[model samples]
Target chain A: MSTQTDTRSSAVVAGSFEGDPRRYLRGLGGLLVFLLVWWVGAMTTQPSYLVPGPLDSVRAFIDLFATTTAIVVPVSGSDLVLPTGLAHLTETLFHYVPGLLLGASCGVSLGLAMGWNGALDDWLRPLVRVLRPIPPLAWVVFAIVWFGIHHTGAAFIVFVGAFWINFYGAYGGVEGVSTDLTDAASTLGVERDLSMLKLVALPSAAPQVLTGFRTSIGRCWMIVVGAELFGAPGVGYEIINASNNLAMATSVAYMFLISLAFLCMDVGFRLLEGRVLAWR
Target chain B: MALSSESSVDRESREKITVRNVSRAYDSTQALEGVSLSVGEGEFCCIVGPSGCGKTTLLRAIAGLDDPDGGSILVGGDPVTGPGLDRGMVFQEYALFPWRTVRGNVRFGLDRPACDCADCEARVRELIDLVGLDGFEDAYPKELSGGMKQRVGIARALAPDPEILLMDEPFGSVDARTRDRLHAELLDIWAQTGQTVVFVTHDIDEAVTLADRVVVMDAEPGSVQSTFSIGIERPRERTSREFVDYVARIRDELGSPIDTIE
Candidate 1:
């Protein structure tokens, strides 16, 4: 009887797990369909120079596998290979990961600080508003002159793209926290500096914090591609190289790889969020 | 008269909370003005008044959740500038942290504080049972009924083992039956702990049923208009003649049936 009850409850929970699979699965399926259409369209184009067919792209991709830097070096001294698609994604992540970490941490901290202290908000408001409108891409010129095509250059550009989003989201979240929660927390002996932001403000603003993370995650792809297009390192560079040679299929494939990486990141974060706020 | 030597939150053991010439105003509207009262140690003093009669305002001031506009409030001989944990408060809205289970909410005050009291968990369990929540400790506030949520709020207020409990119309949101049940439950908790409590309620029956003394205030710059001693025996019968007499006298003075008070 107990086993039967457990089975029934498990079945109920398993059924509810289908809650938003359509949102993710459909998104995944849609990307595949888009790639199929691109592949077919490239095949129909007779001029190989104008639109390299999927076969030509596959050949180039395979060549990269033969010559690619191996992630795990074997003691046997046999040459190891990585799939071109995966290598390109990893390259993109090199820029994406560090930029996101630095930018998000700084953004959330500064935003919270400003939101919590009215005096600080007053002091920084004018300066932040003036600087906020300048596009992150505008700094690419300086990025080139200073870093000169290094990973740091690409990361700098990526940080510029991601930071503002996190800052704004955290700012809105902190500011939107209810004053009543502050009073509630303080009534229980949690105080001013350690208080509203740490206990009440952060919890009340969780949904907004998630929004900021989502925004920063989305911005990473754009910055990655933009950095590559501007002569910075990564798979964005590969996409530019393929496009210049009119390897339309390879360019399309690289785009799909980056898209897949982003989709996986979104799914991972969503899962983490669901688990963390299980009480909600 | 009891626990006078227990160092209650008063300079004079007669008054647990002293709100002397207290007044508060929001722009032109006065929430309280020249309102003063003394609640004694271990006393279950209920404040009864009309809507917007500053009953909640007075309790908030007593809890140090709000500062009086003009006068002074002293708890244990210390002038309160802001809220302190020495006084625990329960609001009309239940005020239990919705994200926490019943036991979690009750023991929230203990989470951060350094303590060696081995019976802390046992006391929380006792409180949950005392408030009729032993089986519902794992349940969230959203899962509980209105009465149960209020019980959790009461449990939370008592969690810190504060000297006084300030309740603002805590049972007002529940139906009559549930409210009555909670009234009985609250009295049990009070009796068990001997905690000083100042409860705010507009229900005359409720005030007379639970309180040792009922303080009724008039509206518009609200201040005490009258006081009635229940003086009824323990576990007072709501339908008893004395209970009826106290309820009727206050109701008559208020000049309406319960519905007419609206």
Candidate 2:
């Protein structure tokens, strides 16, 4: 430890924006190869609907946004016209955003509380163990029965998926906080319990907690699609509905839409994580 | 316990810290046994001993981070029930909060909300300058050298203006040259602040260089073996005959390692 020299703000030279072009070109080359293979598979298939070439999927994707659909607003009792692509995307976000936000918040809070308090941890441990193994999909039956085939029902499944990941992430983080740090805080006039937790343990555990949240961000997207498959109005429904009609290209296009949405969200989340967990 | 009120008042005025027959055992092992010591106001006292001598346990007991199974610790005539702001501690690992910058770590003991107020910022800036880390206020612990980190730790402990400073082998991890520099800086700070400091270390030379009075302890139910007062003046030469004599005498009292090995 003593041998290490100070190496901060010095490793990176100014105005050196040079990044390796070969790596970027290589990634582009890989994508082109994948597209070629997919095109060949589409050509050889007995029916074009069975396999979608990249070009066909792209065309279908464009048509989804170009076309308009009438959506009935339940609260306003009015018919709203929006692009087909946006209507379904909005439906997915309706559940996905709320479910993830609510579940992750509750999970993080409870996990921190339980991890910090020994008696709370003991009391909750058995219940968490029992509930953890039951898959999120297994709750679809209860979600439909309890909330009906509405956005709330689909949101519940997404919530369940997000909750567990964040709980374990926060719990493990708090559990791993070094006792030396807390002892240091205690001597510095910060009392034990909540203040120590907020000032010392929370910051210590932040990297892990944020990593879990990022993981859930991607996971909930996958769960969002699954939740909407059971007659809820969203991109997942469009994918299944198009497939039943043998419009495989449209199904693949909606699948692409989901992928693009997830990518955008993941990138945005990474930027936020970089700012918040800069100390790591 | 039987001391008269008049003598107790004098003791309180003269002594900054008093540990009375403090005993602590961990499960099957006795970590500290009937240890008693007093540190005078504004005194620099170092506890020197071999490994497992409960020097750290005794320091923790004094810091109120740990409680003795039997006996008590008093700071400013008040019984130490738990860790309080009157005493500040520095650890060997330089346990600065990794999430905070050098300025943040130093300002932590101030017990104020992190605000942009002039008074708080000036106090923090003064501490940073005092520790000779003027330009590196925004640097995190991971970006710092071991010496710099320990300096931050020292600054943080001093920020609260505590009456007593407790340190546990705070310079153990730094290189020798850095340790010597830190020794001088610590002495300078001690002179400036006049806070009674109790430092624990295994290095005999460190004890000799930094301590006004060195307390030697022995293992196997750790207890104080003896105490030596160095009459050497400020910035005493390590090579001087008097300084060398004190180190040798303290080493002799510690019992040479060959005796333990045999």
Instruction: Report the CAPRI category for model 1.
Output: acceptable
Query: lDDT per residue, candidate 1, A1-280, as tens digits?
Result: 0111111111214545467787788889997897688678777877866766666766765665565554332234354456766666666676678888788888888888888789999999999999899888787888889877557778887787788888888889889876555655566766567654676777666777777988789887887788878876567888888888777667866766677778999999989887666555
- Docking quality tier of candidate 2? acceptable
- The TM-score each candidate achieves on chain A is 0.79, 0.92
Query: Of the true contacts between chains A and B, what fraction does model 1 have?
Result: 0.21
Per-residue lDDT for B1-262 in model 2, tens only? 1223342224335888999999999988788999999998878899998888899999999899998999888988889989878899999998899999999999898863334567778888988888788888898887777888899999999888889999999998988888888888898887777778999998888899998899999887989999998778879789999999998999899996622442
Across residues B116-228, which tens digit of lDDT does each residue of candidate 1 receive?
55878887887787676666778767666677777788888777788888888898787776776677767767766778899998888788888878998877878888888
Worst 10 residues of 2 chain A by lDDT: A1-10
Leading candidate by lDDT: 2
Candidate with maximal TM-score: 2
True contacts kept of each: 0.21, 0.48
Residue B109 deviation, candidate 1, in Å?
1.7
Residue B14, candidate 2: alpha-carbon lDDT: 89
The CA lDDT at B64 in model 1 is 77
**What DockQ does each candidate score versus the true complex, computed on alpha carbons?**
0.29, 0.40
Clashing pairs in 1: none
